[model samples]
Target: MVEHSNRKDSRAAEAHQSSCLDPFGTWKMSNAAHGFGYPSFVSYNGLEMVWAILFYVPRWLWKNWEAGKVSALRMDLNLGIISEVEKKLKKKLLIDYMYSNLKHHNFWAYRYFFCEFLSLINVGGQMVLLDRFFDGTFFTYGIEVMSFADRDQEDRIDPMIYVFPRMTKCTFHKFGTSGNIEKHDALCILPLNIVNEKIYIFIWFWLLIIGFLTFLVLVYRAAIIFSPYIRALVLRMRYRRVKRECIDMVIGKSYVGDWFLIYLMGQNIDSVIFKDVIHELAKKLGYRSRDIGET
Candidate 1:
């Protein structure tokens, strides 16, 4: 009996080990079985495109220009034979030279710095999304509205309480006659075995604070960058004071003017200009109109 019991216990231990090793029910399963996959491909690709366009292209052009200048200077300063030797050395040690010049290359340094900045933003956004996904999967509960009850048992009914799955917690709200809600109340039904809620609260608080600060920084940066364009738009709107139709015509003519008109439209500036620029344009084009407004 002792030998049989030992064999059974050993088998149970082996089974437990197997279960732990193959948590996804199959040994061939991938890491994606545990929810690892592409977080946000669209966002990642868009950021990469923007980075390539705004940072990479300019950096590449600047580097090429600098390389050309260096080559030209070397050609201009050196005699033909020595310059040929330098060219062969440059060809052989191109990588080494590039690395050595990296310290002095402002554009190259700025490109890497901008890439690091973008990486930080991308990682932060992905982390936030991942946290949200986890929170939604595990911590969130769905509510189903059932029958409402009058708690007061009087003509003036008390707020209806919405009890969660665990009956200890509920949310209540009373409707007033004036189509308004009043006397909102939420009751937390604490479990007999209490979990430390403070940590969760702290995490959410920290995320909120960090996210808000990041938002403010981005807004400030955007405002600074676009201030010149904004100023130009405001000036144009103030000075031009043409109808929306005329603005449209101007936009059709000039891309910069189009952006300014878009800004003006977003600002909801008064379009009630007495003078119609389109009408003037039409007249210039030898078209007759009875009313500028009709034109």
Candidate 2:
């Protein structure tokens, strides 16, 4: 009697677990024959919704506000006060940070760097999410698809077919008129996988490209942080009229944060005014702009 009761309890526990995992019923997913689909889509859909609303959207808006807004620091400070600002730029004075939070006047250099870092994290996270959702096959999915052509025709089973089967069996349970249970079985065909396979393949390649580019962006950020040459090079690319000697001297004296502030200033102010500022800054730092009076 105890053995029978234990067997019944075991079956009840399994039923409860299955109901928790598949609340809508397993008949929608699989039957006794095969189990190709997973319940991961529920988590994946929730992830997309929560990640976008809580994570991506707020950062996107903040980044846009920070980058697209005007810089009063670029416009307000001129040669008249270049002497004062030059002192601040060269040394970490007590008052330098007082003006840091004024409207559109932030250096935002480290914020920009961290945004790039988040982008790397985002790409990496999506890869992991896909891998988890696809049952760990997503990492090598692209490779398997690419190499499928080289295999023997008979041996070449499309990876998409295994990942997303076109056909499966379903079983449904119901109550009969006599109070007994009724079972209904049917074979289901998923035409959607035809389009889904192609879509996921494209996403796989696109993620690779985005991941590579984000890594390069991080590398570039690090390069500018460590190398003054790269700092000057970036400034030169933005405003051509700033004399090379002035840039070299200015960057040589400027901290990475100050240099980054100047770099961000490039997009806001006029190039001619920008050139004049560089020249005056160089003069304040006791170096002359090389191309004197040259347009």
Task: Give the top-scoring candidate (lDDT).
Answer: 2
Model 1 Cα shift for residue 112 (angstroms): 9.1
What are the lDDT figures for the candidates, one per model? 0.36, 0.62
lDDT of 2 by residue, 90-114 (tens): 3222113312432233255667677
Residue-wise lDDT of candidate 1 within 42-142, one digit each (tens)?
33345446534643543564465445434432322233234545544533343233223322544433343344455446435544553454323111211
**TM-score (all chains, Cα) for each model:** 0.22, 0.69
Model 2: lowest-lDDT 10 consecutive positions:
12-21
Candidate 1 has a TM-score of 0.22
Q: Count the backbone clashes (under 3 Å) in each candidate.
A: 0, 0
> Residue 109: error of model 2 in Å?
1.7
Q: After superposition, how far is residue 197 of candidate 2 from its true place, in Å?
A: 1.8
User: What value of lDDT does candidate 2 attain over all alpha carbons?
Assistant: 0.62
